[model samples]
Target chain A: MSVLFFELAMTAYLVVAVLFMVYLAGRSETLTRACQVGTVVGFLFHSLALGQQWIAGGGFPVTNQFEAASFFSWTLVLVFLVIDVRYKSHVLGAFVVPLAFLSVLSAAFLRGNVQTIDPGLRGLGLTLHTSLILLGATAFCLSFAAGIMYLIQMRLLKSKHFNALYHHLPPLNACDWLIGRGVLVGFPLTTLGILSGAVGAKFVWGSYWDFSPKQNLSALIWAYYLVMLVGRYTLGIRAKRAAYMAVLGFVAVALSFVGLDALMGETRHF
Target chain B: MNLIVVGLSHKTAPVEVRERLAFKATQLGEVCRQVTDQSAADEVMILSTCNRVEVYAVAPNVDDGFATVSAFLSRCADGMDVKALGPHLYHYPGNDAIGHMFRVASSLDSMVLGEPQILGQFKDAFEAALNAKSTGMVLNKIAKKAISVAKRVRTETKIAENAVSISYAAVELARKVFADLHHQRVMLLGAGEMAELALRHLISAGVREVVLSTRTTENAHKLAEALCAEGGPPVRVVPFADYAAILPEVDIVLCSTGAPDYVIGPKQVSAALRARGHRPMFLIDISVPRNIDPATAHVGDAYVYDIDDLQSVVEANLEERQAEARKAMVIIDEEVDTTARWIRSLEVVPTITALKGHAEAIARGEVERVLNRLPNLGEKERKLIEGLGPAIINKLLHNPLSSLRKEAQERGGRDMVETTRKLFALPDEGAAGDAPAGGDDE
Candidate 1:
């Protein structure tokens, strides 16, 4: 049942992505409305899939690579829907929906035998650690999308292209605001996630600071966002530079979450 | 019924001629009523704007309608007659007229393609016609359909999305940099006609404040007073030497001065960006020798556009509007076909009804004559004979009636209606006079 819902959600996201592309090209209100409806429908099916998996596995569904990718995409879509409604910025979906779709597509390919959670790892601290970190990652993904838009818009302004892409994009200030908002919201959540993981690490491994690959990488991701936040608020490093930083920070986060776990065979995160 | 449009637009008439022929808003109703009364038109609408003056009407005969409307316009002109206005007038009949109305409403026929004012003028014209009682079922339906088509084009295409002039281009660029200009400040360096025009555009865009600076303090104070008198955001005059100190607080800088060398350069702009915490700044240099340094554009978050650059932007935007106009034309074409089909169907309705009525009358008369001769026949037998005549008539007319309806939805449906009427020798009921029951008003 979980697999069925996941497939259904993936199909909806694919449709939503295609509709957003057409909406960007044509700029028709009807197409925008269709994209919105498709996004909402996909989000509902994704939630159902995650809920089914959690009930079946008797824990949150972020244990394996497949479940982690699926959970990340679900949170990304959740954040996108919130921003979309709050700002009425449906144009942002053109950049973000495809990313979400790719995330789910990778999850589908990484699907393997479902594994039940270990009894020792089933606690509130572990759940908080996983959920907060995934949610923070989702927020950073939003910043990545905003940064890409900001760079494209800035180039158009600089080069005086004023092409269709330039006309369709939000203002440079709006893009910068999105980048700031993502980091502002994601930084604290990530800090809390890392702290919870530290406390949970002591209970599971009898150590508060192990310097494991995952622990080191998580701290690295946290510190990268910390610099971005501080630079934006105090040091006055913003606009183009901030956009570049947001994009690079997301790259680090993605590497820490996926590449480190896959390449380093001894990571205790598995 | 035939739909016809007659008059001249910027494409066909000079401004002098258009102005002379244009009707006042207060006179639109009276003029529409005059056309309907003096001509063969059953309905009339007059759209009079600075760019175009056109008459939309429904008439029984296109030729008569065209001639009468032409004569009416010639007489309405201030000092022109039929011969003087003849070359300027254009008349479109049938579906061409409907297509022309859709194009005009959608701004495809505008002097500035994709301009927004034409649609509002069109709606006002229709309203005037409605007030004058000069519009009937056909005009009402066509006008409403045109309005909706205009709205559809606006939403589906980016025709009106860009700035097509220099001053507006500056505003458009400023909007691209800042999310909202309502909180931003504008600094006007020096004073010139184009500079003031751009300043007015920015003010209307909701800039919070304006600071004027010039080489001469008296000129600056005079300009500041003039701008303040217009009742917008507060205007302050800063000395020419101190303008650099005010750069950090300004988001948009407009420079148009007679100075030979560059006034604002890369160094000053970079320093300002630093002081403003790297906020974006838009610099527009409209002077001939370029008052702002071009190298400032290389500074982070600083956009420098000279006069030539602004002109190029306008040209590019115009080209974009043209591309969007082509898309709008496609939408207009589809709507024209749909509206033409609806009108065709309307044309065939009366003919179909008349044909059926004519066949039924013949069948009833023949049945009555046969019944009179067979008086000894039983009542049930008489009823069977009566039913047989009507049944044969229904069977014989079914194919032709259904085909007439099918043909009415096509391009050449009017010919089919005429042929059907002639074959049946039915009375020619003017299609315009026979308004179908439940004819919608709008």
Candidate 2:
């Protein structure tokens, strides 16, 4: 029953995301308000459903592919909501909601048949590891959105396009500041997640660096983020280059989340 | 309703008259209040800027609201030569007035075509009027429509697509020359206004170093201090005569001195380029008397964008944004129609009330007749019949009543309502409520 509600809530969220995109494209303020209300309601239902599942499963809903993917989408929306509240920018929804929908859609289709939770895998370290990775992924997602905005703004400024979309976009200084802040917050969590994963591996498999495909890809993603941060400080990369690096970092993170699991023939975490 | 706009702009009125008529930023609220209190118009809004002073009002039963607003404005100017200023004061009634406002909000009417500042000014004016409670339904509709149009113009038109201002365009040109400005050094050759604006833009663009040189040490020091305080690197105020000496160090030089003759002559420029080893320099000549000699282009690796060249760039940018301005106007037109319709719907109230009144009156008269016929019957029976009669009348009228109530919420439905009332000859308020109807409310 709880799963049913969760699925229903997710469906609503997907619809609301589409509506929000339509609202932004049409530039309909009335529709934008409706989209906000719809998204908020969807978030509430999603939260309620997740709560029910947590109680039913006797753990946080971050166990397997279905739960983790769903949780990732949920966290992204939560972050988006926070940004929207702080910035009061309905424009963010145009970039954010689509990704949220895609995340949920992937969960629905790719992890439909994954086993719920394996009782043996339910430990504090594993939960913490999963949580850190998810949080880092969420931050990366936000940075990617901000990066896309930065790139668009750069292109517009280059081409001398100061149209409505350009005006709606926060200034270059503001975007850089936001992306930097996102990275600043996310970098430590990502570093901690990788370190803790190493520790978890040692406990589970009696080795810290076993060169698993996932671990290797995770390190590569970390290195990409490191380049972004270093370039920003040392080279003083401001707008376009910084944005591209952040975007590249997100892509690397996404690949690590999915690519290695596929290579290992491990559909358990889909 | 006739839409009217009567205003004085910098183009039409002298500084003395415009200043007199101008609603200073401080006095905006007070002016709005005075206009609303005195005007026979159903709505009023005053838009005053350094460049334009406008009074928009909707007159009751007047052919043109423009004359009324014009008279009001003339009175404000205290018997100045209104005719001389009147020619400059363009008047647009009805649709023209609406279109004029749309253009203004979209920045089509601004001194600088496609500049974004007027939109903010318009918003400020509307907010001020709202705060003063001077705006009525007409002004409210116009203000909102103006905003919608401005937004649409920004989105759909090519207007505002480019950097039209010399300062912003200079920054763009700088970017093209140098991929990044983070480490670039900028030099100012004079303490002119144009130079200051351009320098400010460059500093905001993250230019690291700024060196100031002007005829006066006081002016140069002042500019340097201001720039340094704004987070840019500490500025160096070089002596005007030492520009030839300091010219070798900077990557970009912005020149706008007021000298009668060419300040940076061919000999001076060539020698400086030689000393600098021709490592590519960007010079922007914004002075009318032309600070940099025209022959200086012969110097290798130096790219110059003069004032006229910058003006052409601005013109091209303006053309692009002009297309957007039209698109925005179309959107505003649609909003205006929508708002007008909504306002028209206010007419439905009278129609609905009249319809309800007629039904109540008939119901009451019939109940009275029934009571008279049943005078010999018991009081309980009489009360029941009376109660039953109202219920039947209410049920019968429910659909029409609900529809009229709904219509009242729609735009332009009010006229339809008044027509219905006049056709049905509904009685006045006192007669309508005198029906022998039973108690319906708790």
The candidate maximizing DockQ is 1
DockQ of candidate 2 compared with the true complex: 0.03
| Best of the candidates, TM-score | 1
CA-lDDT, candidates in order: 0.88, 0.72
Evaluate every candidate with DockQ and list the scores: 0.64, 0.03
> TM-scores for all candidates?
0.84, 0.56
Give lDDT tens digits, candidate 2, residues A166-260.
Answer: 54566554566667877877888888887887787778668888765676778887887776777666654545566777788888777777666
Query: Which runs in model 1 stand beyond 4 Å of their true positions?
Result: A1-45, A64-66, A101-122, A212-217, A262-264, B36-42, B216-231, B342-442
**Residue A204 in candidate 2 has what lDDT?**
69
lDDT of 2 by residue, B1-442 (tens): 4557778776677788778778787778788787766666656777898788987776654544665556667778766655655676877676667777887888888877767888998899888888888876667777887888887777766667668787777876676555467767899987778778988888888888889988988999987777767676768888888888887788788999888878876676656656654444678888988888877765544567688777777776777666666666677677666554544444344455567667777878998998998789898988888887679868987886666645654544555555566677875535554333221110
Candidate 1 lDDT tens digits, B243-337: 99999999999999999999999999999999988888999998988899888999989988998889999998899789889988899989998
Worst 10 residues of 2 chain B by lDDT: B433-442
